[model samples]
Target: MKEKFNEAAFKERLEAQTSFPTLYPFKFIVPKKSLAELKALFPNRQLVFKDSSKGNYTSVSFQLMVPNSERILEVYRKAATVEGLIAL
Candidate 1:
């Protein structure tokens, strides 16, 4: 069975390393065709993309000033809806 997402553990880790309202960097690896969907998640932010050497996937990274753990968790939750997204 797939283990449920451990949001509490993730929040604890974030709290340890980051201050509130910090510029958090998010990264994801997704199939090339899903780039648009990933971009939709951060409409106003600039997303940096790096194509995999084989060109089947792309690595997307972006930095946004997140207000709190709730917001960060929210973004991840939304991203999880995308097909073949691997949160980094």
Candidate 2:
């Protein structure tokens, strides 16, 4: 079964693990077709995309200077909206 991500717990963890204004790395694996929608989440940042060996999937990752846990969670919220996105 797929594990459910608890948004509240994750927000608390982010608060404990990182300080405000830190560089945060977001990672996700998604269908190649969803690339555009994913990139739209971080329009000002450069997203690194690595194509899967079979070329059907893409691994997306990026680092952004986030101001606080709230901002980090906001990114997660937007990311969750993408279809077939696997957060890592």
The TM-score values for the models, in the order shown, are 0.89, 0.90
Q: How do the residues 2-26 of candidate 1 rate in per-residue lDDT, one tens digit apiece?
A: 7877999999999998899999899
10 residues in a row with least lDDT, candidate 1: 38-47
lDDT of 2 at 64: 81
User: In model 2, what is the error at residue 68, expressed in angstroms?
Assistant: 0.8
Give Cα distance to truth, residue 48, candidate 1, Å. 0.2
lDDT of each: 0.90, 0.89
- Give the per-residue lDDT of model 2 (tens digit) for 63-86: 988899998888888998999999
Q: After superposition, how far is residue 6 of candidate 2 from its true place, in Å?
A: 0.8
Top candidate when judged by TM-score against the true structure: 2
Error of 2 at 59 (Å): 0.7
Clashing pairs in 2: none
